[model samples]
Target: MRGALNNLLHGVRLICAVIALLAFGMSVAAAQVRFDKQPLTIETGAGARHQLTVELAVDPQQREQGLMYRKQMPTDHGMLFDFDEARPVSMWMRNTLIPLDMLFLDDKGVVTHLHEGAVPLSEAIISSGGPVRYVLELNGGAIKTLGIKPGDRVVSRQIGSAG
Candidate 1:
């Protein structure tokens, strides 16, 4: 009986150790996600505009994992996707828990189109009707709240920096 109890205790300790290691690994990976702030300005035909701080998603891998699994984000925070070249771009929200508004931009940072209040975790393809090089994702309903329209523009120094 004593030997059996000792074995059980050892197994429990091993499980605990494994769980701790996995948790530590997750934290390490999350740490790699840098939220570098860049200004993204939006213009409305009503003679007004809004600015937001965005995190640049400049690489293929980062763009693939854009905002996935994140439970929440600040209202003023967003992600900017830099395609590095002019082309028609499509986006989906698979594995994303929060709704987002997607803005497609041309080479000059002019907003060419938008998808507002995109359903969370949806696999629907959101596309830029014309060739574009940048895409911006913000919280759902932000486009209406900020009065952002199709002709509105977005600006950031991170433009064309896909690294």
Candidate 2:
């Protein structure tokens, strides 16, 4: 009888451990951030327009988690970080799994600084040379392939422009 009780207790402990692990996994899934998608356009210097759909990272928590674990992003899809105001901003790719090209934009959505082909999983600091209100991150080499340059203007509803 004692042996049976011990076996039952062991089974109960195993069940509890499984439950705890499932709960932890659920919590982690719940904590993953979801972003709102928006339409954005980049008007190049020679009057060429490039359209893209981007996920907005507007809040502190969303910005903090900016594409850290994402393994892939679509060619025309990117993440746009709105800082709310123009200020010098810094970024890093500590846990990022894919290379990215970062475009720093001023208050008028004009690209001010560009950092292309940022190494994945790197902790090196990438900075906006000047104050910027937005940072648009795209797949590495997208800028050159799209012929996007520093003077290009980004138009989006969030940037006070018609999408």
Candidate 3:
């Protein structure tokens, strides 16, 4: 009888462990935040238009994180890092996997500088010579393929409100 009771208790513990794991998995899945895809339009010289889907980072913390540790980013998807005040901006690709093209934008959303083909896992500082309030990161070759260049006017809607 004692041996039988011990076996039953062990089986109960195993069942509880499995249930806990399942609950944790569900919580993680629920916690993931998803944003609606939005079109970002940029007007090039000679009145040409280009569009891409971009994710917005409006807050300071989100802007700081800036897609760190992301293994893959889709061709049409990118992150737009925003700042409250325009200032000289710089970035690095530490722990990043995919190469990216960084579009540094002035307060009016005009692309002031383009840092194309940023290497992965590199700590080299990529900077916009002037103050910029926004930075958009897309696949490395996207800018060249779309004929994007400096002085292009870019537009994007922030995902969520400051509230």
- Of the candidates shown, which would achieve the greatest TM-score relative to the real structure? 2
Of models 1 and 3, which has the larger TM-score?
A: 1
Q: Please rank every candidate by TM-score, starting with the best.
A: 2, 1, 3
Rank order (by lDDT, best first): 2, 1, 3
Point out where model 2 deviates above 4 Å.
1-31, 161-163
Using lDDT as the yardstick, the better of models 1 and 2 is 2
Looking at model 3, residue 75 earns an lDDT score of 83
lDDT of 1 by residue, 1-163 (tens): 9999999999999999999999788656765766556787776777786878898887777787788778999998899988889899989998788999988988878888989989998999887888999999999998888888887777678763433
Candidate 3 per-residue C-alpha lDDT over 32-100 given as tens digits, one digit per residue, 9 for 90 to 100:
634345678878886888777887777665565667667788887888877866899889997577899
Candidate 3 Cα misplacement greater than 4 A, ranges:
1-37, 159-163
Question: Which pairs in model 3 have colliding backbones?
Answer: none
Every candidate's lDDT: 0.84, 0.91, 0.79
TM-score of each prediction: 0.77, 0.81, 0.72
Candidate 3 displacement at residue 141 in angstroms: 1.1
Candidate 1 lowest-lDDT run of ten: 154-163
| Per-residue error (Å), model 2, residue 13 | 18
